[model samples]
Target: MYQYTDFDRHFVRQRAAQYRDQLERHLRGELGTDEFRALRLQNGWYIQRHAPMLRVAVPYGELSARQLRQLAHIARTYDRQPDGPFAGQGGYGHFTTRQNLQYNWIPLVDSATVMELLADVDMHGIQTSGNCIRNITSDAFAGIAPDEIVDPRPYAEILRQWSTLHPEFAHLPRKFKIAISGALEDRAAIGWHDIGLQLKRDDAGHIGFQVFVGGGMGRTPIPGIEISPFVAWDHILVFIEAVVRVYNLAGRRDNLYKARIKILVKAEGQKFVDAVNEEYRRILADDPAGHEQLIPQAELDRVKASFVDPAGVKAEPAVTLDDGDPAFARWLARNVHGHRLSGYRAVTLSLKRVGIAPGDMSADVMDTAAALAERFSHGELRVSHRQNLVLPWVREADLAELFQAARAAGFATPNAGLLTDQIACPGGDFCALANARSLPLAAEIAERYQDVDELVDLGEIDLHISGCINSCGHHHSGHIGILGVDKDGAEWYQLTLGGSDGSTLSGTTTPGKVIGPSFAADEIADAIEAVLNTYQRDRLSGERFIDAVKRLGLDPFKTAANAVRVSTAKAPA
Candidate 1:
């Protein structure tokens, strides 16, 4: 994790103070709602369907245990839903696919205080929302992954500092996202981002990036195209600036639907690439500060130095645990992962248990997680893009003890990549943009698939859900995608098969195809079960769900799903 310098600490505190002043003025009626909207959005505050929602940025998903403790304090003390469906039920935080944490019930009047608290811990929501470069995400197993080409944290941190409040690209046509993957596998889902950077080395052993541009999800789901095969690591910032500059100048502003850079890139095609190249050439030749912007060796070294392994961790002899206990064996296989270091193992603290909404960690759970991090992970923790907390530095010898503690803490479900480990968003219940609720449906599916044996037999499945077309839950990337829709004021869901997140398991980055017409909300779970049953019956030996879907096509699964879709009148309560 990058340690904040004195300047970095001061910057967030000053920004928090500025936000407080702006919030006070807005509350006092001195600032109009429309004017204050932009001000508040820049600081990551949004008025949702029921109340104010605050999204706190977690850069590259790294967090200190102290920071996690403070977050728990904030949730316990200030987060409460006073009205709507969730009135009196709060004090929990929701982790997002973007690796940010959201609080849906925070009062607007108390938001300034929350900002100040965040600043105290060198954290803030600056540039987390609105039409700007959002928080840069990377593979969760960045530094410790065995297949890593380079440590991407330093570059991701450098990008984070560069894009935060950049004068030129603060506001673009639409919200922009960038993801980097240093691993051989695309764990960060880089192909689905506006700018996807894959860290690589040349034949001469020099670092560079393979850049992809224009991918996104929504009404139109398109994978990004390779804009540049390899850009020198030192020139990444300048090249990215050129790409954004082209989009800022030419991207559509007429319709919100067509305002994204993806749309612009799609429309312009090779012309867009040509324009970006021209812009890159001009920046280096014509712009006064362009050459100066190229990262110097000393700056790179300074950033990389902070990413070194913690002082206490050492390379010890490798060992494995094989207790007679089946539960322990299951947890060891599913929740634990191999580490680059000899002795260390990465363990996922499951947040997908039944009863609680997926990724919603209560105050107690957060505090316990912080304690677990301190005790086992060198006081550092990581928030995975899949909305789970990871102890990235747990010693191999500590697996049994950690498992026992984690089980007591309610996060040791041993279903890390299983069918029950679903990804969902706070849908219509909280988000104003949602057409239907996602939590209930996710809960229903989770409740049905509790047996670990059953889940393992089903294999690793990415079942993602979204309330609307916004794709916050990344439903388009799921092997089993469920998208909530509206039908004459009733809730319906559209099922899509064969989506993937571009991992070793999910081979490619592609959108799932809808099987047929949408099903009533009540019939969606049955429809999903029917599809899964079809896969179990017809799949070849050792075939995964995604492979079967691809090999057999969507016809049989479509028939199975349609067979289970009942009429609105026939839907069970």
Candidate 2:
């Protein structure tokens, strides 16, 4: 993990003080709600359905055990639990898709105090929201993945520093998201971000990036188009600046809905590419030092040095486990992943426990995770894009003990990449923008498929649910996507199938196709079961859910889903 320098610490403290001053002014009537809106957003404060929400940045999803403890402390002190039969125990935090942590019950007056707490741990809410470049994400398995071409953490950190408060892009047309993937697998979902950088090796074994631009999801979901097939590692910053410059100058600013770079690219098409190329040429020509000045080698070296691989890990002979626990074996198969180093594996601590909101973590759970990370994973952890915490360097020998600890903490669900492990957003329960509640649907689906054998049969399914078209839950990229919609003031779900984040190694990513009419909330789980049943019955030997759906189109699955819905509607009362 990157250690915060004195300058970084000072900068965060200063930013927190500034925000505190702003909050005081707002409370004193020096600033009205409208006047304080932009300022609050920049500081990661949102006036939600019932209370204020605060989003704290976890850069590149890296967290030290100390930082995790601080986050737990913040949750314990600042968040509130509603009083009711449905009320959860207090001190819970929500992990978001962008690798940030959000608190839903923050009070307006306590915003500054929250920022100060984050600053103490070298974390902050800066650039987490508002029309600025948001948190930069990278492959969770960056340095340790077996198939990695290069570690993306250094480059991500460089981008984080450059874009944190860049005066030129502070108020761009809209917010921007950037993702970097070093592994052959597209775990970072690079295709759906505003800017995607995939590390690649040339024929001469030189490292560089394949740049994709204007990819985003919302009302208009589009995969990013490649702007540069290959960019030299040293010149990536220059290329990024060129892209941003073009978007800032040519993107629509009058209409908030049309202000994203994706809209500009969609409207202009090839013309946008030509403009970006022209800008790149101008930027290159303006550099007297031949683009080397953009990202100095020394700066790269400094960042790279911070990410040295862990030492003292030795290769061990392959060991077989005979714990006689089918549950343990199931967890090992799904939650554990291959590591670059032998005798070591990356373990995902699932937040998707049945009946709980996806990505929700209590304060005590965070402390347990921190302790486990420190004891077994070199005191470091990574947050996955799939809303789970990853112990990136756990030794295989520690597997049993770690599993037991995680299970006790409710983090060991043995359901990674399965139907029960779904990506979801905090919907109508928290966000004012949501059309319907998402957590209940996710819980119901998980409960329906709680049987271990059933999930294994389902196999590698990516089910995502979003409360609205904002697509915060990444429903557009799921194998079975559920989108919440409001029709005639009633909650309904629109199901989409065959969508994927695309495999970069195999070169395939397609958006989900809508199957049929939206179904009522009560019918959602059965509708999903019908789709699963159709896949199980029709799939060839050893075919995954998404692959089967791709081989066989939506018609069969649609038929089964509609049949279930219709049968339920016509059932005797």
Candidate 3:
């Protein structure tokens, strides 16, 4: 975890104060809606379909217990409960795919108060939204992953500081996202970000990055191209600056839809690479030795030192699990991940509990999770890109006790990588940009697949649902992807198969392909069941859903899904 320096604290506090003043002016009508819109967006305030949404940055998905406590407090103090059975409980904060926290019902007037609260914990909403470099994300298990070539947090922090309030790139043609992964497994979905950096080692044992540019999902889903095979660690910042500069200058501004760097890269192709290389050369020529080199030796040492492994921690020798409770065994199998340390294991606290919206947690649950993290994980926790909380340093010996505690706290749900552990964005219910509601559909799917035995039989599956083509839910990366769309006045869903976030560690990636025509929202679950049935029938021994789909193609699943739809339509009402 990167600690904020005195200067960093001072900067955030000052920015909060500035925003407070701006917000007050807007409320007083001194500033018009149009004038305040840009300022509010830059500060992470969005007027959604229902109420204003505030996205608080959780840099590199890391949070201290103290910071988590502050977030819990914010949820209780500022957010409002919806009208439902869950009402009267404190506001439920939504964890997003970007590893940030979103409160959907925050009042517009309290936006500055939220910023102040965040700044108190050395956090802020700066550059979290708007046409700026968004939160710099990395592998959730960056430092502790056994196969990681380098811990990406130090570099992510470097980029965070460099990109924060960058005047030249703040108002670019479109918003930008960057992800870095040191693990061979692309847990951070590096291929789908605007600029993805995968750490690699050379023959001389020098660390560099394999840079991918322009990969994104939306109306146009394209995997990033390898822009640079090997960029030295020291030159990464400069290289990124060069790439952004090229995009800033040449990316389209005429149409909002075509403004992203992906569009620019699509249009220019190899010429785009040439332009970036030329820019990189010019930047280096001008600043042979300057502050533009964000990661100097001293800075690297400082940042790395802050993230040192937990002191005096020892490995628990060869512990055996309690096989008496089948439920505990299931939770262990699904929620626990191997850690680099001998005794420690990374535990994912599933936010995908049935009946609850994916990634939504009430303030009380947040507090309980914080307490659990403090007690078990060295007072530190991480938010995964999959929209779940991670206790990165849980001891294997304590798994049973932790499981008990988690069950009481509503965090133990024996489904981490299963179909029920779906990733979905706040759709028409919350997001003004959405064409249809996604939470209800996700809930329906989760309810339909509550059978633990069935899920285990189904094997590992990545099911993602997005509200619209923006792909906020990362539908294009799921094994079974669902995208919500508007057809006439009805909400329809388009299904895709064989997409993955590269979790297989195979060093190759592919986006999902659409299976067939869109289905009505009501018919999606049955259609999904039909696809799964086809997969079960056609799959070779030991093949996963994605592997089976790829080997057998989408035709079989498509045929099965359509048959189900047709049969259901013809049934007597």
Candidate 4:
């Protein structure tokens, strides 16, 4: 929400003009594919399955309604080129499992124009799609959640600026993700982020963060280690610099597969981690405090004010969604959430529609959302790490109309917290980084379970799938986890149970076991059914699937899952 100062404005314009020239060269054949790949990534462009995909940074999932509107306009204008861009191939833009928007199937030569278009709106594509620091993500329910100890956005914004195009940290050994969640609940999936921070108010009445290090999912699954219990707000950026500095120097650079910070954290113990951070902090302390001194106290305050009205946006008395149409009542039950605003709500766009790929949205859809964001919401929209869109501020009275518009645009999926509402990465089908196909398996699990009544009866559960060990899909923290692995040249799934996403996050209770190969989506669904059945009959009353698995141990579930030999004991007829 921080207004772009003239300095910031001028800087972004310069960056955009620079990228435009690079794009022109890439198209003119002056830049080879390899060279262009690196440059395009730095500017948030990627060559995906269909066409070119442009990734727009959401900056830790924060957006101004105006910004959201602009994004929508770009999608509608660019993706749907009159008779539609690229004919039938291009439709919706993709909202990622992280905090960014991906518009795929873009014509290679025309992308520079798109970059210029975005720059006109006070935005840029820098570092968004790169191996550098991708979009800095935070808990979706950050400040507004009732249980938060302190708001963490001001800190996030500060880091957002410092990390943007910092020449020293741009190209690392591998990709890095960082998450900061203030809520007692870990909505940001922080456990899976490379660097996770939980904001807390110290006993001395100072706002600080509990720093977590390592913690990622890839070929190897590792949980974050809480390296420091109290890192004051002022030192947050400096501390991060230290961590990345160490990784940049020692993290594996020879093999792309083992290059992630996760491996480095694994190679070194927590004590060694502390020493690295301390050493860098001391060196930085000796300096004349360059960037820190440049950051004005007013900057933080300005960003704070940009946040959607924390005390409610409307002048009227509170009106809950239950007071309106039955549809709103249903949406509120699923997509809508309580905000710090007394009479306002943060509405979630559920990604769990039955047959559709959970997070797929056409470019036109993105445009529609931008229009609605302009007219109804605060001109801001946020993409949740769960792969859902969020309109963070809506007056209780406008709920019905807003719901109608979203439903028309195919944004209505009333299963935000339900079991079918899942998190999945682009598997072998889309991502070059994948070891196994994940989307088909996810679709299979989602469609196989047809009973809504049964799901409600079972209560809320977190189910996650990842194509490979890379924890991009957050497989490590799922109540029920399915990781795709390769064996004998065939794609296989590794099922894990009892992963937690809280402050004291836990890993899969037992080592994940490989499920059958090339199992259709339907069979995967049955596999889940079998796991649930084990929990249903054996679980103590009031115990959820995760708790039951934790209490009874993974052996029971393992035995029960292996019992379903893929051919028989199916989920549905």
Give the poorly placed runs of model 3, Cα more than 4 Å off.
Answer: 290-294, 505-507, 566-573
Tens-place lDDT digits, model 4, residues 451-473: 66666666677788888776667
Per-residue lDDT tens digits of candidate 1, residues 266-339? Answer: 99999999999999988888756644878988999999999999998879998867678999999998999989
Q: Evaluated with lDDT, which candidate comes out highest?
A: 1
TM-score of each: 0.97, 0.96, 0.97, 0.88
Question: Which has the higher lDDT value, candidate number 1 or candidate number 4?
Answer: 1
Tens-digit lDDT track of model 3 for 122-198: 98889989998999998889898888888999988988988999999989999999999998777999888899999
Candidate 2, residue 280: the lDDT equals 85
Candidate closer to the true structure by TM-score (higher is better), 1 or 4: 1
Candidate 2 Cα misplacement greater than 4 A, ranges: 83-89, 291-293, 314-318, 504-507, 566-573
Residue 179 miss distance in model 2 (angstroms): 0.5
Candidate 1: list runs displaced more than 4 Å. 82-90, 287-291, 568-573
Q: CA shift at 483, candidate 2, in angstroms?
A: 0.3
RMSD of each: 2.1, 2.4, 2.1, 4.0
lDDT of 2 at 342: 80
Candidate 1, after superposition: displacement of residue 176 in Å?
Answer: 0.4
Whole-model alpha-carbon lDDT for candidate 1: 0.91
Cα error of candidate 4 at position 341, Å: 2.6
